[model samples]
Target: MSISVHLDRITDPIVAQDERHAGSSVRQPELRVLMATRYGRLGASSRLRLLQYAEPLAEQGILSTARPFLSDNYVKALYEGRSRLPAVLAAYARAPALRAAVQEHDIVWIEKELLPFLPALFERALLGANKKFILDFDDAWFLRYGGEGEAGGRNRLVRTLLGGKFPTLLRRAALTIVANETLRDWALRAGAANVLLLPTVVDLDHYPPTAMPTNPVFTIGWIGTPVTAPYLARLAEPLRQLSAEAPLELLVIGAPDFTLPGVTCRHLPWSEATEAAMISQCDVGIMPLPDDAWARGKSGYKLIQYMAAGRPTIGSPVGANTTIVEDGVTGFLAGPAATWADRLRRLRDDPPRRQAMGSAARLRVAADYALQATAPRLAAAIRSIAAR
Candidate 1:
């Protein structure tokens, strides 16, 4: 139901609050942190926001254990367009166990809510008087309740019941960690008292900057799961236009069956073992998102990956993309409907410029979005919340 957060540097007394072992015997305070994640490792939010923090936090003597509401099977089913009703029901059935597991930990670091699609009253009641919890959000999850688009069209009763869910959780959390300024602003507006902006990051060790591969055709890369593949499809018109004028290859990773009629689209099954290497094969990277509330919540992780791989990026000028790409310096930010083709053309014709931009992009990522740079702060933040 839950995993225990073990502090290797601290004795058991701190967990028990035994003052006798607190003064000198303990090197560091022992704190058990429960990672109440939404989904298992297959979910990017859980993987990047919660699971990846385990090793980094352990380095600072804090051990974190995660218990996801939804299993990998649920995520796999969702990605494959299969029915997830069975998995969803199974997750809801496990809710009580997760609720009961909360009492055993010092702090609960939650990725989104412990349960989704339920009313906030029930979710809060499930948490049950525990104030030692931190909330993390990488997406504008609140938008799903009643903001716009499909969310606004939900059944009136469901919308009324769920619209205030995130705000209620935010106001109660000991701390709130958001992936970008957009999410941070939303949390602040929702009455969150203490908030921290921690962007989605790549481990620099795994994402080594490599020289662009010498290929016969210029390649533009995009990496994302099937759910996000539709965003990449927005560039079809631009890519189609570009393909007509030049030898272009659209390297799509993760979504193995993606295709564009006129463009030479190459699909590679995404694997951790080959992602970095696959990214290296690109001359440039692209993240094309529509301007919308849900899209605005994105952390621009695709651009970060591209930057880390020493490839210049061109992203839709929305949310984190505006901040991640330094316009003309590290990468370009163009409207998906406006200048995508023109921007792609610029990078295609200039090899030297691409190299220079890639270098700049990598440097920017190392300085700000690298996991190594933020791990200490993240550990400290969680430790501080646990101590409180």
Candidate 2:
């Protein structure tokens, strides 16, 4: 019944203690980290945060080499079929490639949702001398399959398969990193001894604020992937009501299927560079989500992107969004369409408040969640686990 099924070297506190004590002031090793990812580039939040930690890790003599497990064809199949099995198998079968990549590194870091197949490969590599394994995830992948509330039907099946594979992988990892307190708690309950909380971070320098455009129309934008595209429907009524009075434009980047009546909708193809630029052009950014378990696992990266771009964000009060948006200060957290409509109207009418909130959001991200500020903590965590 334990969440962790087979983790080695976790039960021995003495080993962790010995590794820490012996390595005190020993000048940490020049670590080479191998990262296994589904996507090859730093496009998504998970990949971006891992990349953000790389520069700091390098400063500490840690070099990271990333090897993407799934190909574009495999990912296309996953989306086209709306199933993860084929993608999962392809990732698992990439163990030979993963093993080859790890030979060039000292440790292996598996990003979220990849544990199902890669764990066996990781275990095989760990048997070698001086090789380490680190597991990183932002969501409760195990609970996604069969956990209670809002998860049903087809989603239940996906969750069940994911949950089964995740624990098996976690049990074999040397250390585990989770994004928030909720996920950390879940990992600990699953018997992951060295679970650490490492939230998603933004590159503050890359997303510096530009002068607000003196446009004739007020724009509200949303940026996310096709997976999260459906939540835009929740805002259809609110956006329609807002557009009834003002020149409100709705710019949706990455959601090809998204459309709204009475509001100007611009769908941009999903590219990291262009998406960031498109998001920067908006007057206000919106993050709307249904209250659900899967949504709760989101690390508020959308809000972080908006904040880093110095855009005031309006988000549904769900999961980490509530924690990121300091309601009424940095941004507003509205529950219903009526409240969403009211906030949009207020921001539309008041330019100064929007400017002030945008400034505050930028400051918040730079201080707490920027890569420069957060990477040290991540490095220290790696150092801790690596020593063990």
Candidate 3:
């Protein structure tokens, strides 16, 4: 299951590796990295953290070669309510091509595993061939397949078959990159010696705030995939109560079919080009989640986007939300379903508080959560691993 890391680099003789960690700085004119993403750009996890690195890393002499297991169209299928078996099979079919291309690269940056629902050892050949590897995670994926969730709890077959691979893969990677402390702690517990906490970020410059407030109604927004649309319902009753007293509207981007009874829900389809502009116009952003293990693994990218757009956010005090939102300073964090209504009312009634918090949010993003702040760390991690 293991081979000399030097085999993949070139025909150079074995170097003096008598005493050093696997990742040591070595000069290579150019480093080719095969980034095997679980899903294409439409996938937030892979898009923000891994795929976005292509151009930036190249400037550092690290060439990125992306091999997405799931096509963007496949995401369209999932939302269309089509059977996923075909797309899942197609991903598996590309295994050989992806594996064949691995040998030519200096390192394989695994954005999640090569394929889902497959045994961990399915990638044994790559390890056997001495391919250098790095693992990255923005979500608590271990709980998705291995912990409590619909995928693991109800679908016993999938849990039985594909669940155990993540821990095995975590232990095998040359280095692990995590988006938050929760996942970093899990990787450390999984026996990952080399782990990096690289938070997911937004390019603040690209998401400049709206020039002026022009919306017909004061908008409280939320953005995410349909799968997470249910969390929006958590705000339905709260928003309904606030709506009775305030001139507010709810914008749910990325979930055109989503509806919240008792609340005015404006569902808009999500597109890369329009995402920033759409979020920038919102007065406040909301991310409501039921306190659960799977929800805890979430990176709160929605909050990051809203904050980058200079919109204050209100989210459940869980996972990265606790760190990203500075409670009353950046945005409000609701403690329970009971307090949701009061929180929404405060933000809606006090425009001054909303504007101040939103400004703080944008400043926070520019200072710490900007892509400019974290991309270099990623380039360094990739460069160091490739050097090994």
Q: Pick the lDDT winner.
A: 1
Q: Who is ahead in lDDT, 2 or 3?
A: 3
Which candidate would rank higher by TM-score, 1 or 2?
1
Write the number of the candidate with greater TM-score, choosing between 1 and 3. 1
Q: 1-388, model 2: which lDDT tens digit per residue?
A: 2222111223334334533554366676677887766565534744674655677678767788877766566655543457666666776677566556767777788775444433344454443555567788766555545533355325645654443455555666677777666666667766665665666877777786786657868988788777677788898888888788877788888777778777688887777666667888888999998887777777878888888888899999988888889999998999989999999988899989999999999999888778877666556556666665
Across 48-77, the per-residue lDDT of candidate 3 in tens digits comes to 888887887786678988988888767878
Ranking by lDDT: 1, 3, 2
Give the TM-score (vs. native) of candidate 3: 0.89
Instruction: Tally clashing residue pairs in candidate 3.
Output: 0
Model 3: residue 56 alpha-carbon error in angstroms: 1.0
Candidate 3 differs from the real structure by a C-alpha RMSD in angstroms, to one decimal, of 6.0
TM-score for each model? 0.90, 0.83, 0.89
Q: Which stretches of candidate 2 lie over 4 Å from their true place?
A: 1-27, 42-46, 76-93, 113-131, 147-162
**Candidate 3 Cα lDDT to native:** 0.76
Candidate with more favorable, higher lDDT: 1 or 2: 1
| Alpha-carbon shift of residue 214 in model 2 (angstroms) | 1.2
In the range 85-168, model 1's lDDT, one tens digit per residue, is 999999988887886678777888888887788877886787788558889999888877874455353767767888888888
